[model samples]
Structure formats: structure tokens, C-alpha cells
Target: KKKKKKPRGSGGGDPGCPRVSKPSDDLQTSRKSGFFSALPLRASLRGYGFCMAALFLFCFGSLFYQLNGGAPQILQDIRHYLGKKFSLPRALPFPSQVVYNRVGKCGSRTVVILLRLLAEKHQFNLVSSDIHNKTRLTKHEQVDLMKNISKIPQPFLYTRHVHFLNFTRFRINQPVYINIIRDPINRFLSNYFFRRFGDWRGEQNHLIRTPGMKDDERYLDINVCILENYPECSNPRVFYIIPYFCGQHPQCREPGVWALERAKQNVLENYLLVGILEELEDVLLMLERLLPHYFSGVLDIYKSPEYKKVGNLTGTVRKHTPTLEALQVLYHRMRYEYDFYNFIRDQFHLTKKKIGLKSASQPPAYSSAFLRELTLRTPKPLDEDEELESDLEDKWLLWCPS
Candidate 1:
């Protein structure tokens, strides 16, 4: 028999996974607080066998990435280079340092809620800053925050609306990244006219208190604003997907050829999962599979009552005021975003197929029963990490020497 490996930090699992204690299913109390506190002595023959298996799977993810091709230009569209990119066949996890760089108006709140639920359910620490309505965290503040997390006893999930940037500068364990993007057109519309409009609308807000509101007209004022100064409007406010994904830099917002390419490449390298807002169900299912260790029981929570109540408020359109014509005209002014949207849509479909899921672009019809199953609520505060004990055993056994 082989031996076992020690976790680099406390509460760690497997060999190179997160160092925090495995999150118990219920956050109210730890189911196995001392489960991995004692490091198994690997000097024995049996311990060595266990160590080899654990280490192989731990590094298998990197090998898979190298074999699966890389970010390259194709047909002048870099999106094709991201072939089967978002889906991970083998990957490692370091949960405490995981960061969800939430982009604004990208249905990011739903992702945050899901992360919060996972943190609470697993009993992992969640270092969510109460900071709200901001685009980026100050570099010094980010550095200090990461430093503080190292002193804490549990793993953490940092979820907030922040643009992507090099976190290594903060001198921390490089965080595993995950985020979702939206059809730029829809995201633009959502940001353009949702919430705080004519007091929940059938009417319009006369003041147009929105920042960067150049002209406070009664109608689609941004339309006119674009015609007068296209670059100023499109570059700053409307064309945001590239800037958000590309990380914080002046060149990122250049609205040039290199800018788009850099954003695509950054996504390919940094983010483990880059899901689309349109194929949300597939994304959630994908999360459970890819990070099964961390998101084990998350799949069942979708149908629970507390999950639904939390989900519905953010899932559906809270209100709407834009017309089809408004979107059509807006599209004309935002051709770059249109290109970005189409590329990501194709990427999502291709990724689903590579991972053995039905093509998201052409999903089959769901029965009424299945449709209702999606909304039937279950009690809140999700269950324990039942998969941990079994998963640990099953994974090692697969590689045990015969």
C-alpha cells in the first residue's frame, strides 16, 4: 500500500486541494472538525501508494490543459482559439483563495448567492467584503485583505463586483478564478434601463440621474449621445465586456484590435470556468462536475425553497422598459460588442459538447414536470458534504496499486 500526503495548509483535502478543513454540509456545525487534523505518516509502504495516486490526479489537470490546445488566433476571431477552453476535464482546487471577479449587470449576483450558499453549507470562511456598487478594489486594500485571510482558520470565497487584475501583486496564493459573461447587447440593455426607473415603470424617470448621462432627454438619450460622440459613449459605458474581462489596464479599454485579443487570451489563461449568462442551467451543472469537491451538493439546492426564493429575486427581470427598436438601434452603435457576444455564444455551445452535455445552443424541450421541478422549493441552509468521505475513498482506490 502507498502513503498519504500532507495538506499545505489547514483544512486541506487531497494533496494540492484547498488547505481549509472540508466544509461540513451544514454551516451550523462541523461534521468532522478533526477529520484531517492528523497528518498520516507517509514513511510506510501503504502510505506511499496513497500519496502517488493523490499526487497524480492533483497534477493531472495541468497535463490535460497542455494537451487540449491553447489560446490561438483563428479566422481573425480569437474565440475559436478557446476550443473546449472553459470546460476542465481535470483540475485542482484551492478554495480559500478562490475569487469570483463579478462583472456588473452580468447576472453576477446569482453567482454570488450560489457562492455564499456553498461557503455557508461547507462551513468554509467567506471573506466577502461589504463593499458594494464599485468597479474595482484599490490595490492596497486588496493586498491587505488577502493578507488578513491567511491568518483566518477557514477557506474563503471572495465574491464582489470587481474587474480582473493581477492578484499576485498582493503576495498571496494565486486564486482559482470563475466568472460568467452575458450577451453584451443584453447586458448593455440591462444596465441601461433596469432598477430605479419611473418608480418601477410604465413611466420613465425624468431626471435621468445616471452617471455619464450627457443629455437628459425624455427618450433613449444614450442613442443621441452615441451619434454625437461614438467612441466616448461606446468605449466607456457600453463596450464593457472586454474591459471587465481583460483586467485593469489603460490598454484594456483601447477599443482596438489588440484589446479584444488580449481580453480573450486573459480569459483563456486566468479563468477556470467562463460561463455564459444564457446557458445558466448548464453552467450550474458544469460547476458541480468541475469542482465536485467544493460544490458537491449544490446541484440539489437549485430546487430548494430557500434557493428558489433567493434565486427568483435575482433570476428574473425585476422590471423592463426597453423596446426591441431600442435594442436594434443600440446594436448599430455597438458592433464590437455584437462580435464579442456571438463569439462567446459559439464558445459556450462548443464547450458543452466537449464536456458531453447536449449542445446548449440546441437544447431539447423540457417536460412540464421537469420545468416545474426546477422551481419547487426545498428548505434553506443546504445539506452536509456527504460526498467527501466517499469521494476521498473512491478517488484513491482508482489509482491504488493492484
Candidate 2:
């Protein structure tokens, strides 16, 4: 006003006068500045709130589900939480191989250990069920998931407790298929006693019914519950043995019908390399032939401890003879498949004389420690050499049981 103040809303204004503008421009500028100034802070707070809400929901949901006695669901939720925290690569970097292990208390763990060690040494990928696989998924669900996930066509090694039907679909050109079969009588006895009192939890008495149960129920009872409920049995028998050697139990056994048909089909279709756990030295030799680069003498494989362990045998309630007779009866009922296993053994040129193999025909070694170091955790690399020495001592005792 003193020196021609001009219009206050104009671009140029007096120094002491407050600036005024057209209502439209003022509104537009105010809106823009306001938004820009508050945008980052608002976004950050929103993100934090979202995470907190998710965490709260998950914890509340888990507790609610557990309280409802939905054990499977609770287990699944826990797995999901752990999985998200420890996600592995979708595919391993190097080409991986598959191994199908059959049942027996027959050193299957040692084989798994060897394969894991080899995979690590060669920088090849080892696909394990626990790390990341749909093994825990139901059969139908797992098959569908594998089909979709397999389309990526990356070279990765995967191993799991899979059935023959599921395993045969993979186009493994020269994959190694391995299985170890023990004497049917011994195996049956092992199965029977292990189910009775081993650390295995779940329906135990359902193993051998007290008569009047339907035959199919009997089969389901024996085949399904016994194998599924026990961890040791579940791992070797259900996962590897039944699938790789004996196929799923048939609805009816017509003549020429057998338990291992599907496994036979898979073997014919794929380059399967079967290994007898009893003849481990021969198995190692076959591995040398199959995978020369990795198995070559660069590493002394023989230094690997003997599979047998000397330990106390539990569940010896009555005289061994009666138990042996009962096992013998069961063995004969399943002898057809046992004969097939023997044929495979013969084809491999594995001989009992080559390795001091044990059989049902051989008398039981009562003093032998059959349960040696069963609870020992897998030794770390730094402790392996020492563990090996201890195992060697244990093996000496096992060999000279009496």
C-alpha cells in the first residue's frame, strides 16, 4: 500500500505483505505439497502395521487350531512357518541323481549318508524330502504339484519316499535304482518286534490282529498302519522298499500277479542299478562302474564303517524258537516276492561268501549288539573321523558277537 503494493495474489508482491493467490491454484498446490510431504511416512507405517497384523493372526490361528485337536493341521501350520523362514532354492544348481532304497534294518541310513556326502563333495544337488519337496503332500496332491513344478526342466537331484507309480513318471535316462533286501523271515521278525515296543508311537496292537478282522482290513492293518506309524519302518519300507521293490498291495492276487509289478515296470523303463545291502562291497563296486568320476579311488570308500552294529536286542519275552517259527510262517506267505528279491540278488552276481552276510537260516547271535548307536546323531565333518573309529570298534564286536 505504501509503495504500490500491486495485487497480493499476483506473482510479484510487497516484501511485508502476505501472499494471496487464486483459489484454484492455491488449492492445487496445497493438495500436492500435503500429499508429497506425508507419503513416505504413511507408507512406512502402513507396512509395519500389515506385518504386525499378519504375525498376530498366524499365532492366534495356530493356537486355536491346536486347541481343537486338529493335530495334522497344527503340524502342517508349524511346518509352513518353519518353511517360510528357511526356504531353500527351488532347484539345485547341479544335475542330481535319484536313489530308491528298500527296507531292512539293513544299513539304509549309511547309504543315505554316503549319497549325501557324495552330493556335497561333487557340488551336485541332493533333493531331500525334509529340505523342500512335496513328499508330505498327499499322493494325488504331490503328483499334481510335481508335474507343474517339473516343467521348469532344471537339472536337480531329488530323493524322497515316493511310490513306484509316482517315481516312474520322471524321465531319468540313466538313473541309479538301488534297494537292499533282507531275509523275509528276519525282516518279518524285525517288523513284528519293532512295532511292538520300539520308540514307535501310534496304534501298535493293530499289527497282528486277534482274528475276525476282515482280510482286507488285515492287509490294511498290517501294511498300512504298521509301516506308516513307525518312523524307522515308515522311512525305509513305505518310502523306498514297498515302492521300489514291492508295488502297492493289489485288490486281489490273480495267478502271475505279484507285489513288485510296478517296480519291475519302472526298472524296465529306467536304467535301474540295484544294490544289495548285504553285499555292500559289491554295491560299492557297482557304484564305481556307474559313477566313475565321483566314486573313483580318490576317496577311500572302504574306510566307511561296516553297516552292522553290536547292541542289545529288545523284546525277547519268550524263547527265540517260537518267535522264529511265527516269523517263518509270515515269511512263507510273502515268499513269492522274497524269491523275486533273490533273483535280483543272483543277477547282480552278489554272493553270500563275498561278504559275511546273515540270513534267517543262520542262527541268531544272542549276544550281538543289534541296536548299537541307533540313537547317535549324524556326526559333523569335524567329528566324522573320530566317529568312524568308534564305529569300527563297534563293528568288530558285532562280527564276533559271542
Candidate 2 error regions (>4 Å): 1-96, 101-104, 130-139, 148-156, 166-176, 195-243, 246-256, 293-324, 350-402
| Alpha carbon lDDT of each predicted model | 0.56, 0.43
Q: Residue 372's C-alpha lDDT in candidate 1?
A: 37
How many residue pairs in model 2 have overlapping backbones? 4
Q: Could you give candidate 2's per-residue lDDT for residues 252-371 as a string of tens digits?
A: 121124445655555555534565555566666555444543343313544544422211222222212323333233333343445555565665554333433333233232212321
RMSD of each: 26.7, 23.3
Residues 1-402 of candidate 1 have per-residue lDDT tens digits of 787756565545456565554455455344344443333443456788889989998688665543332212242144323434764332224554566777767777666677666765444555554443454445664565557545544355566555676767665666778888876666765665553342332333424434334344324455453444433244345657776677667666555567677777777777777788777777877776566544556667766888887676543233343343444444544455555655666666767777777743633222335323433431121112211111111010011111
User: Of the candidates shown, which would achieve the greatest lDDT relative to the real structure?
Assistant: 1
The reply for model 1, stretches above 4 Å from the true place, is 1-96, 136-154, 169-172, 198-233, 315-329, 362-402
Per-residue error at 203 for model 2, in Å?
Answer: 20
- Pairs clashing in candidate 2? 96-157, 310-369, 311-369, 311-370
Q: Pick out the ten consecutive residues of candidate 2 with the lowest summed lDDT.
A: 393-402
